[model samples]
Target chain A: EADIYQTPRYLVIGTGKKITLECSQTMGHDKMYWYQQDPGMELHLIHYSYGVNSTEKGDLSSESTVSRIRTEHFPLTLESARPSHTSQYLCASSGTYNEQFFGPGTRLTVL
Target chain B: GESVGLHLPTLSVQEGDNSIINCAYSNSASDYFIWYKQESGKGPQFIIDIRSNMDKRQGQRVTVLLNKTVKHLSLQIAATQPGDSAVYFCAESRGFQKLVFGTGTRLLVSP
Candidate 1:
């Protein structure tokens, strides 16, 4: 089984509030990614990291920021949450191998 | 603009029947393709994958077909069961970098 985990499986907050989503993996992967997905919709790449201290923006523009402090941790932060930002955030990690393993996901709701 | 997409938004199949999900990608240079299954309120799980050089690959009751000439890919599940209900996604990658995920397809298996 994949050893990836995400904290706060679900979150609800008011608009303009700051929030952070945590992601970690025990598989010692070098590549980590964060994606935004709406209900039954396409997954939009928000942020990704190659390894510690390396981060890059994905194809879709997102207001959230992510940091890769250690090989096993990648966290995403939203400075000011909005109703539009409410969606499912999925964290994934992949090694040099072909497939990626995903976390259970965090459902964020900004009222 | 350039991305991977699913042809069907949803597919329903009776139990013990065979189901097929199709996907189209615009990047001809993509050398690897993967299929993923996502249950409700969870992130995607890797199902199977196929390389550009291969036209077909199978895992258990699942099969993946890759057609580079048409830039199309497909996933087939045999003896479908209720547990197979979920959203399916196809992703394409080149040079082993970030993967471009297709619009999801919801598979609803009926008993």
Candidate 2:
């Protein structure tokens, strides 16, 4: 399987609560990405990083933010959770010209 | 804007039958493409990949065909099995940068 991992495979939280979704890869890939997917819909790229200290917003507008302080870690945070934020968050890492390896994903439910 | 899309939203196949899923892209600049399989409540899994230079690539049971002239891609599964049921996505990327994912195709392999 892929070396990528995400914490809290499922999460349920009340509105206005702060939450962080964790993602890490042991492959030491320079490229990492975070995608949001709703049921029966396509995956949306929310945030991506080329390397440490390098992060960029994806095509979709998202309230969630991400940080890449370490090469193997990319964490997505929400200032305050909302009901609209309920969805599955996927983490992926890739090497040059190769396919991405994805984590198990975190299913978030904001109450 | 560049984006990827699937021709159909859902595809149902019988066991032992061959299956084909088609995808289209708006960006000719994208030279790399990858196919992913995602089951319910799980993250997407890498299936196959094809670069612009190649027209076809094959894995164990899956084959990806790329038609650069038409900016179209297709995934063919030989002798599809029930375990092959999942949502399939085709993604495109230019120069190993951020990828644009296509609308997903839910594959139902009935036994």
Each candidate's chain A: what TM-score? 0.97, 0.97
List pairs with backbone clashes in candidate 2: none
Q: lDDT per residue, candidate 2, B1-111, as tens digits?
A: 123222448899999999999999879999899999999889998888888999999999889999988999999999999999999999998986677888889999999
Name the regions of candidate 1 deviating beyond 4 angstroms: B1-8
Which 10-residue span in candidate 1 chain B carries the lowest summed lDDT?
B1-10
Model 1 CA RMSD to the hidden true structure, in angstroms: 3.2
- State the weakest 10-residue window (summed lDDT) of model 2 chain A: A93-102
Per-residue alpha-carbon lDDT of candidate 2 for residues A1-111, written as tens digits (9 for 90 to 100): 339999989999999999999999999899999998877677888999999999999988999999999999999999999988998899999876557889999989998
Please give the fraction of native interface contacts (Cα pairs under 8 Å between A and B) kept by each candidate.
Answer: 0.43, 0.39
Top-scoring candidate (DockQ) = 1
CA error at residue B21 for candidate 2, angstroms: 0.4
Off by over 4 Å in 2: B1-8
Estimate, for each residue in A38-95, the C-alpha lDDT of model 1 and write its tens digit.
Answer: 7777888889999899999998798999998899999999999998888889999999
